[model samples]
Target: MDIGVALRDLGQVDSTALIERVLGFDEQAWVENSYRQKQYDVHTLTESVVMIFTDGKGWPNIEVSKESGWDLLADVAMPLMHKIIERHYPPGGTIIRAMAAKLLVGGVIKPHVDAHPSFHVGHRIHIPITTNSRVRFMIDGKPNRLAVGNAYEINNQKQHSVMNKGKEDRITFIFDYVPPEQLQRMQQMQQASQ
Candidate 1:
């Protein structure tokens, strides 16, 4: 579905500062081990953090990569996230299931579709920081470079992939957005017609 005409600008937060804090993170805490697929070009990096959020019903995964430790949803990052949620998914709406944050050292996620459940509700959004121009968002068989201060909405239900061709590690804050009621209604109608 196309983005609504009345798109909202989630307040801008200090992207650099937030990333700095994330890099300073300490990984002493023992969390569940993460799953890494061999399909994506994997490599070791300075440090990275993967955080997952579930809205109960749908899958809403958000991965925030930093130069080091992961610092996401800081006071600065909150506003933008809230605005995104408000603009795309209504309050208390959607069933967010999982989120992941991966740090790529010039790594690439081979072109592929996300898990089936992920395609049903939310679309993935990426925020590039500390990343070089080599990083690209391949959506619908087209490559789109993510601009640092700009937000782009992606239909994960469609085909897409991530690539970081630069030498520097690319950190993208990725998350999912669910369609609001009106959009959902239209989706149902379209499906019924088909």
Candidate 2:
């Protein structure tokens, strides 16, 4: 969504629980979901523990489902994701995607807007679990540094990119939400087209 700004700070959040659980996951847990990297080649340098995802393939009627990482991270991840949503977003919205993404050292996600249909209406939120000073996230060509203990909602409709030049990998939990009213209008439009 083009939130009228490049990024909106959603204030701070206690991500200790989620961070601990994510850091403890074995290598296999991270690789369990290769859909992001496989489907979006630009994400090759990143890995994710995806809890839920919706490709918005069946327009007017979206398909959302729990992925393998749901079992592993839901206990700790849900509370954080929900807390942020309930505070800033309205009720009855659909969370199209949720995951903890890792940008490996020296990783570079080239500048690009999220072109998927779901992305147009979904509010993309990001919470930094771990980050170093060397990491830089560019939103609308402006350099922004995301800090831990804070959450931000980025306008996915604008151009954005990330690069991790730090020695350690940068980890951030992200989720996409489509508000109830907007979602309803979106579905209706798609149905009319069909």
lDDT (tens digit, per residue) of candidate 1 on 1-194: 23332122343444665465444544541123333332224322322344444322321222223311123444445455566666655675442322224456566666665554544555556555566777776767877665666555666555666676777666656565555764466457657766
Point to the candidate with the largest TM-score.
2
**Per-candidate alpha-carbon RMSD to the true structure:** 7.2, 1.1
C-alpha TM-scores of all predictions? 0.61, 0.96
Report the lDDT tens digits of candidate 2 across residue range 1-194.
98999999999899999889888988898888888889886799999999999877877577899999899988998888889989999989988899999999999988999998788888999999899999999999999988899999999899999999999999999999889988889878877988
Error of 2 at 163 (Å): 0.6
User: What local lDDT score does residue 127 receive in model 2, on the 0 to 100 scale?
Assistant: 90
Whole-structure CA lDDT of model 1:
0.50
Clashes of each: 12, 0
